[model samples]
Target: MNSSLSLEDFIASEKASLSEAMQMIDKNTHGIVFISDEKGVLIASLTDGDVRRYLLSGGAMNCRAIEAANNAPKSALSQKEAKKIFHKRDYVVIPIVDKKGRIVDIYTGDPKEQKLFRESLNVPVVINAGGKGSRLYPLTKVLPKPLIPVGDLPILELIMKSYLYNGCADFHIIVNYKKDLIKTYFRENEAHYNIRWYDENEPLGTGGGLSLLKKEIHETFFFANCDVLLDSNYAEILKFHKEHHNVITMVCAYKNFNIPYGVVEIGKDGVIQEMKEKPLISYLTNTGIYVVEPEVLDDIQDNISIGFPDIIEYERSKGRRTAVYPVRGNDWMDMGQFPELEKMRVRLSSE
Candidate 1:
């Protein structure tokens, strides 16, 4: 276990802002953070999932991180003890504290040591990489959006590996704009991906391209946008879909945005019923990811431009079961827009 990281690197004050805590968590990249009081005594612990659940449960993002921190965090008094707990629990990271409950060091399990126990999921993943990526503009003008580098790998590779890590091997990629560049890149690299490419003769909107896969895929499969990545267990989502008997499971993110000013709710007579300060709002936004049973493919009209959302609605209208699987806020990262792309670049580069 490496103890090179100073306690300051992983410790945050109880009063620290949620945003600050998130940055620390991101910098740590260990999925866990320690929270302490002014006296430098450990008070609580926060994981990326905890912060996300807080926000999803109406906790303000700008509020203190302590609001979401776990007061009864699992910890050990010494490094030796911590190691035992870590191995027994298979925890990714553990914090060590002294007699006074002040964090002295941190212990992290080596990922390399866990390869033999890795769980592999045998599911087909479909990536919609056909969009022009107009949001990225000049950058997309030269390199296709999916090929644009994030850290060392392109966005598409990251999306693929997220699934591959969970045992997914086969892939079906739908491409249209700058299709040749994508095919050529994959051809030259000859990466480990078992890729099958479907070129859209014309820009068939998101769901329309699925018509090409009606014959190709028969089982439940993952469908995702090339520009988004979810830092989550793919197998859990699949299990949820199967257990619930959903025809389609839409993966969503719990997003929180604050209203800049007070807003009033009007009554029937146009009189104000209630008013709120710069209140924070939260909602489950679709992350453009789905686990779909092949039967849903029948709703997609052949070669017609229909967005995925429309397809979902069409399925619902036909009495198909659809459900939403919500992931933490930090778990979902979108690189489709300019600002988000830049943020994702910095975050990925750090990793």
Candidate 2:
């Protein structure tokens, strides 16, 4: 057990805003924060999952921190008891409180403990690797985008290994551009990947390729673009998709942009309705990662060019259930462009 973090870092006031608690959780890197009264008596525990669920349920971020917290959190009276509780359950961190219910220290297990506690989701993954990466230019001229190295491993390999870590071994890869090199590289690699390759005779836009897997995929699976990587919990995403009974779950990332200059809202006939100085704008962006149902693929026409977003819209128009699962802005990484490629490289290398 590690108690290196100061108590203040782990404890948030009961009166604190949900945004403040979220910031504290991000700073702690433990994915949780303790809500305590002014006297430091623990009242509840808030986790990243809690915040996500709160937002999904339409709770406002400006609300009190305790509003999104688990009021009945498991706590221990001593370090020994905390350790036992931590080992016996999936608790990421446990708070040790005095007889008066005042928190003294927190028991955060080893750094690697987080990985050990991740629940495995044995699902199939479909990757769209057929794009002719125009943005990548010269690099694409020589190598496929998926074959480009992020660190020591190819980006496609990194994407596969991520799913592999979560117990997903079945990979259905759709390849077209520079297909020979992609196949040869995997053929020679030492790692034995259970991949089912599908070739597109003509260029098929992102969603078009799914038609090839119409008969193959009979259950829920992951559909992703080759140039993006997501750090969110796949198991939790799957759970949300299943619980909501959604035909498609688009994994979106929260992107925040700050306007450097003052912004004005215009009403009728050049009338200014509202004005703010240097406002911050936040929105959820599609990360090109999705938890998809097999039935959706049946609607995709074969040998046709269509984007995934269009497919989503077509499904939505038909009154099908489609939802969005949001993740932090930094959790989604795109290597489709030059600058982002370098950023992804640095990010993966550091990891």
Candidate 3:
């Protein structure tokens, strides 16, 4: 059983808002929280997956947490029973409830036994590594952006390993800027990665390069930029894409910004309708990662500079499905610029 967190940290009131439960889940880093009634009786359990599903179904964030929770969550009477349940099922956490139906403790199994629980997805990965990386100017002058080291490993290697962990081995890399250096680096490295290289004669935008591989990839695959790292479950993302029957699913991160001053809204007659101080706003930002279907590549024009978002819009115009998968803000990291490079290095090193 995990003891690092207090019982209160694992429990939320039934009347708490969904957003508050989400914040608690994020703080615990366990992706779950237990909901209790006013008398401290267990009512339901909520996870990040549940919240995501609720949001995708058009549920409001201000709704009660119980509205999006599982009312019949599994519970155990003892830690030993919880351990057995953990081994028998795929559950990560179990609540220990007393005869009165109040939660006494939580069981998370042994720390060492907490491995990544994901079904192996042996899919192909396409990496866009041809960018000039003008933001990292001086470093890009000496070494290709893909070759820049985050810790001991290059950024490209880190990106590959993330997919490889989810059982993806086949890689198709499109290179143009400093292509020779990138190719040579992989050639010299001892780690055997199943990578195929493609070259572009002229500078092609992110989506345009996909035209080069028009008929090569016949199945669904993951496409991502070289400089961004998403600390998320790749298998879950793939599952969402396939289950929703979407042609393209863009991975987006929720970023929250706080205003420094009071904000006021005016009415038609110059009357102040509403005023608030230092409001926090949340929005989703694209993380340069996507789950794409093979046929989408056929829509790209050869040698045309078009962004991936433009391709999504074009597909949407044709009545094809395109959607977004939301992830937490800290789960997405970008090393495209100098300051973010150092931050990425620190984040990866601590891991």
Candidate 4:
């Protein structure tokens, strides 16, 4: 849960500089505070995670702390009062400010206790775990792709966290090859989630298996692949979907793959029209994450192996708005290959 900490309660001296902020980060006791002047006008705050992101981004000892700070709680709410509101609103700490409106502190509020809005538990996330990880090769030969351990945890766990962090708790996992192993393992090490399993007796494509999910699914929810790692806040995506009233929202990322030599473009006369250096090309790639309404299940053919793209194209032909939310390059990962698996393990472990 995010803290509803306000700027007022959280403000420390930004002038204390990065050195002082690093010390506080090392202690992990008090969140680094920012004081505007050498005096005591709290302007900003910093947390250990903030330091971690900065550090991972090659931050140095002399780097400015103000640049890395989130500065999120921009609302005009008091510390104590904001805390109460956040609790009643089902959010953790919300930033607050002093009466002067300069950033000051954070408020610690718990939604579980206050039962804010009692958010209707309608969102259902579906993860496609039915693929045979042919790309991962020998490692995946013994274990299912979802069960592959990237670091301290399996890939599926990490994928689930991406959705869980977005306030999604209900999950429908489609299992096929080695289904027993998945079921047995989760049963032994139970996660605090409402997981309703959908078993595919025969191998089915992404769209085919999704059709068999329990009839309880109601509102729009997200669907993700087991082999992809997407670092995003689902709440943001959900809000975007609602504001746009989109029936299908696909998460896309800017990606570029390299080619070594210069390329030439020719015209009809076989004359070189353009010769350019190894120019960088950008692509908006499908990150294998999607936001869709439950009505989409109706398009899936029962007991068929239909890939998701077929359904997406079907929706496109129907004139439904299939929107794409483009994310930055570093936010998405494809761990289907050996090199990518190692890279992801390193990145996640470092964090």
Candidate 5:
């Protein structure tokens, strides 16, 4: 199909939320979303990279789309000139605006028209599926947590496929509690899986499993918990991790919560300084996904039970570079609990 987008599908209001802007970008089939004023005048442009940087800098996703947009965007004054600029700059898409700054049309180019060179990344994935899922209770009694079905497939399979889509197929799974069940399921499944099993003799915390991978993985790899699912683009996560030269990159989600009651701040003289009623609070929280460099594996002590966070802290103490990539809250789901698991099932079924 051709790649031209309708005005409504390509343009978003400047006051629109970040989610709305993302939707417009997705609908347009192009990477850029144009922000327009009430009169349909183009004010700014937003790209996926712009949004990523804004979120990384702690920008709230609930804020106006313009807050993360490029106010000074390149555009052509005429359609004839736009084609020239588009070809010269090799832009994916460029907006053509009139004298009044309104986007009259867009110059669209098919990526198929150009020569593209893409290479697959060879990165191993490590999943910490060892913990006894006490929270999942009765269900955990019969089957391992990784074997639990999300929809048609087990949660662990879904996690593997998520990485598989990004050219990462090699997997190292840490198994302890109900390890036999997990191994059995993978063995019997029709689909061939490339997996190396690491059996922990005893309970090892999240980061402890990496001790087994010290000799196996010699490149950048992905580490994740078996219970969480993130909808963000995995390729971009890897790109960001490598660009920053980080020893470890944690994937975090920005969550928003509204206060249930009014809050007041008072000065020392008992004078009310400010008051807010049910204000929205936003925070970046860990989503249990990571991009780790191979050298960091040396930091893990042998046969020690330590959580991933402790290892991150230890690396920081030694002046290691640790960064975070923030994703929208709705893009992340935790299937550890019954409530969340049900939520994920419903959401996936709809998709």
Candidate 6:
């Protein structure tokens, strides 16, 4: 459990034989300690799993453990870069190298490195999962859209995980269509979340659902759609919203478009000024995520289907500040249809 395994000692030298590599692993529980050469150059690594996999792959115990290293990711600019790429995959382990691509160190991405310190937190979160998901068609016939599975978990689970990863846990799920299925699923599972449900009773537009929570909330909380997933720093977004003193903060993802056919730029009448083929364009789009203050909730009429945006428009009329946080397209996904579901499944499985 040594989180500080140094790569300088575990890596074998260029001339060192396989026998020396085995001794190093034996001393450090087989690659838990970082491996590096005498000149402090990183070369290759052996992990406990590597040993197991090697043996399972028909490798004998006598075989040099160094041979198990699958071309260690070489670090060029810095050691951290190599660590990130190598650890991004299964059995996170890393090899650090210099500008010359010679291994400078070895690292194991300990799970502890991913831990986040809990700060003084008090904000609540509202998740809008009430949609009937008519876009999903036949699939929605039997299950609520939020309850629909994406990979081994539901789309909603991934959404919550993204939020939870940033240390925001309080939640309120808005439900209406197939409320039983939503309730039943949560009841049967052992999820340690402080959650409450607000039923719309009838179909409500996205903005209208937040209107139902006026009575239960009074502070700032993030409002998110269950159908979309966004990987972002919630705490940073909340801080930006507060520092900017904005009433509403929208999280947007930048999407790029490239037209395959020639595109023309014309002026006034029908004169073509110029033409560009496969031009790349970018746009900031609604990511279905938001940071809202409690004051906006008060504008909703009791039991009304008015959603959060309705309040945004109302407040905007009074010159309220509305802002947006832009993220990369890779950080967001919308799975409201069969085609998108297929894409999501493939993407998740690949990850």
User: Whose TM-score is greatest here?
Assistant: 3
> Candidate 2's residue-wise lDDT over 16-97, tens digit each?
8876776677557678899999988989999878878888899876688899999999999988898889878868899999
What is the lDDT, from 0 to 100, of the residue 183 in candidate 6? 83
- Model 6: CA > 4 A from native: 1-112, 116-122
Expressed as tens digits, the lDDT of each residue in 19-105 for candidate 1 is 677767755666678899888788899987687567647787678989999999888998789888988878877888888988888
Off by over 4 Å in 4: 1-122
TM-score for all predictions?
0.78, 0.86, 0.89, 0.66, 0.80, 0.68
Give me candidate 3's TM-score against the actual structure.
Answer: 0.89
- What pairs collide in candidate 3? none
Ranking by lDDT: 2, 3, 5, 1, 4, 6
lDDT of 3 by residue, 235-282 (tens): 889989999999999998766566899999999999999998986555
Q: Residue 42's C-alpha lDDT in candidate 6? A: 54
Model 1 global lDDT (CA atoms, 0 to 1)? 0.85
- lDDT (Cα, tens digit) per residue for candidate 4, span 140-188: 7799999999898889888876666656778889999888888777777
Root mean square deviation (Cα) for candidate 2: 3.2
Evaluate residue 332 in candidate 1 and report its C-alpha lDDT on the 0 to 100 scale: 82
Q: Looking at model 5, which ten-residue stretch has the lowest summed lDDT?
A: 110-119
Candidate 1 residue pairs that clash: 120-167, 121-167
Q: How many residue-pair clashes does candidate 5 contain?
A: 0
Global lDDT scores for all candidate models: 0.85, 0.88, 0.88, 0.70, 0.85, 0.69
lDDT of 6 by residue, 1-351 (tens): 244445445566545433444445544433333345566555655544454345436665445545666446334345566556655653344555666555655555555655454343457878998888999988898888998899988887777767777777888999888988888887877776678999887777787787778778888888888888875456767877899898899887645566788999999898999999976554567878899888887766766666666677888898989977755455667897788788788878965
Residues 1-351 of candidate 5: C-alpha lDDT, one tens digit per residue: 133546677789878887677666655656778899999899999986787798778786677889999999888997778778878877767888889999988878655565332235668999999998889999999888998999999999999887777678899999999898899889998988999999999888989989988999899999999999877678888989999999999998766667899999999999999999987665678999999999999889878999999999999999999999876666788998999999999989976
Off by over 4 Å in 5: 1-34, 55-64, 72-119
Error of 5 at 213 (Å): 1.4
